[model samples]
Target: MSRVSDTEPCGTETAVRSTRPKDLTSRSSFGVLGTLYSAGEQGLALDAHRSLSRSTLLRLRDRRTGAFIEEFTAWADGFGEYRVRLTARARRHYAHHHACYRELYPDIDTPVPRPTDGAHGGLVDHRADRDPARNLLREADVLVLDALIRLQGGEIGRLQKPPIGRYQRGTSPEIGAMPPGLLYREAEKLANSRKPISRLLQHPDGPLVAVVEVTSLLPWAATGSIPLPALIVLTTRGRDHYESHLDSYRRAYPDLDLQLSRHTM
Candidate 1:
């Protein structure tokens, strides 16, 4: 990992960011599955397909040519051929949908949520570090897993998003970071506060891929001024699972802090 000045946002070490184009062109349609993301609102145990089907306005593409046969009619103007109906979901993905973010639905310009921040570094969660409680860790795991699927768009089966309420205050001293939320009021209201999982990208019919966070690198609260830790990730499928296709995830998500887990298989 390269050294980033500790002054700006703290997630760029492995953050997933969008290099938004000045204007949309035909080539913009190339990103199909990864064009969207979502924070699992229903948990990775529900049928998300049913929710996606509700959207009347949809976008389709030519498989061979990778062109947008159906373009966005609403939501965003130049986000490629991504469907317009569930644009709120896509927005959620970019709007601090990762972890420990309290910001709600945010626009495309909103800054990516960070696990740790400037000099204080205390603005982070050590839950995944000091205390790996089964319940809380599992919840975090489910969220990370669903996020992986949303950003990676593999054959993972429909996962119901976990409710945000599941977030509990951890006894771990290091586990004192911000909560997940959105920046804008309108976008926050539109987010899945009522619904589960804000955004999704999947086949109309596909088998759920059983996966979740097996291990993850939680930036520890500053240990007497030590800087934030480099973002790391490990999943149920092991490290190679992501190592092989990491670039794809980065394309959709810029500050994505994932490495790969060496367990689950």
Candidate 2:
């Protein structure tokens, strides 16, 4: 990727207009840009150059390992542009092991009386909000995400879980001979057997500010040299506490604007 000139800082209007992707709208948020999202990049890239008739998958690789990690699908945003949508299930299941940002106005609390006085200049911190533990992973059995994320200025490393096996459900030949309701009845057992829903984060370990990248369709908006939060809360797939109360916060503390990070790390 080429670097932006100092005369036009990144994320600025002039910077955006000079290098807008063919399909993106100036009104669209960076999260809708789609190019930086590995999972949706190809389809977004194709759409940026031309147009795509249908949606497609874009794979996101491990930032540390360069290994195939997870994927997301990309389709048109119905505004003559392509973007990625985060399904509730996918967000609950796959969003994790990444870094995010949060901005604190001078009014927010900080160790420094002047929140802007430190090297961070804006009180930057790293937090890992998702990524569940593999089964049977005791605290001693691993380098947990909470600890790993707080690890500053270190060499990057990779961690892989052993192949996870999932049980397949199939109707017995005798049951197959019956009407489909029989299989539907059998499905109840499987449904009841599913693991309970979990956000996969421990108390006091998530980002103090909201993690916006999990929902990002583009990467640049949430990655690279940004100031982020330690954590506030980690909930189920769809909502974060900070996001849920954003409107109230704006009403109560009208002076602040808690914007999401500008990159998708």
Candidate 3:
């Protein structure tokens, strides 16, 4: 990928016009698939931590002894196959990891009355009314999103369960059939919806935001450096899924402009 010019700072209207035809899908929150080890068992989970410092990354790897991947990948075959299945796995991961973030923004009172800094636990909770982290996340979900997209090919480097085995003779013939493209689509949807729903939950009365993913159709808009628009409409299978939603949101709130990011399928 070519670097943007130093003279032209990213996120300019002039730059937008000069760039290729815009994609409308924009995503705020990025969901990452990871493996965690507990006891002898391993599990798959989603992580909100944006980037791990080199030290933290090394520490996590050292602690696990390559066990995290084996446990998580073995949890199920569906995880690597479909985006929806991955979503389910991520939800489970979030619930489990909630404790880590919760420590920073403990709902329960402690002797220290741990400060409610948004960085630790603020982004995940939708019900907190005074969470600046929530607002910041709503504004910067794209940051999380872009990082995850760039990591598509080799982000999670760890041991994992073996690939799905061949079907048994007694099972139905179609039992193991699943299209590869389907996983990409679902991954796109999950990635796209992350920030929007987080926004809705965090700021029930605030403006609407669009979330999207990078795919083949909207290559022009996939540049990770750009600040995403208000409305995002990613392209897959040569059609835009978010078109009607965008139109409906526009009709309801014209003041909030639409932003798009297209990824060709």
The segments of candidate 2 whose C-alpha lies over 4 angstroms from its true place after superposition are: 1-57, 61-84, 90-100, 103-265
TM-scores of the candidates are: 0.19, 0.17, 0.20
Off by over 4 Å in 1: 1-143, 146-205, 209-244, 263-265
RMSD of each: 22.6, 21.2, 21.9
TM-score of 3: 0.20
Global local distance difference test of model 2: 0.24
| TM-score sort, best first | 3, 1, 2
Best by TM-score: 3
lDDT of each residue in 1-265, candidate 3, tens digit only: 1111234322311222332112110111111122121211233222323331222332222221110111123335554311111233233333433433334334422122223322123323322322323223332333223323333323331111123222122333222221112223333354444544454324443433233332232343345455222223222311232332333332222212234323322
Q: Encode model 2's per-residue lDDT on 1-265: one tens digit a residue.
A: 1111234323333224443322122322222222233333233333443211121122222111111223234445643433334333222212220111013122222122112211122212211111122222222111122222222113121111122112112322321121111111122222232111112333243432122221132233245354221222222321243334434432222112233311212
In candidate 3, which residue ranges exceed 4 Å CA deviation? 1-37, 40-130, 139-144, 148-187, 192-265
The clash count of every prediction, one per candidate, is 39, 19, 28
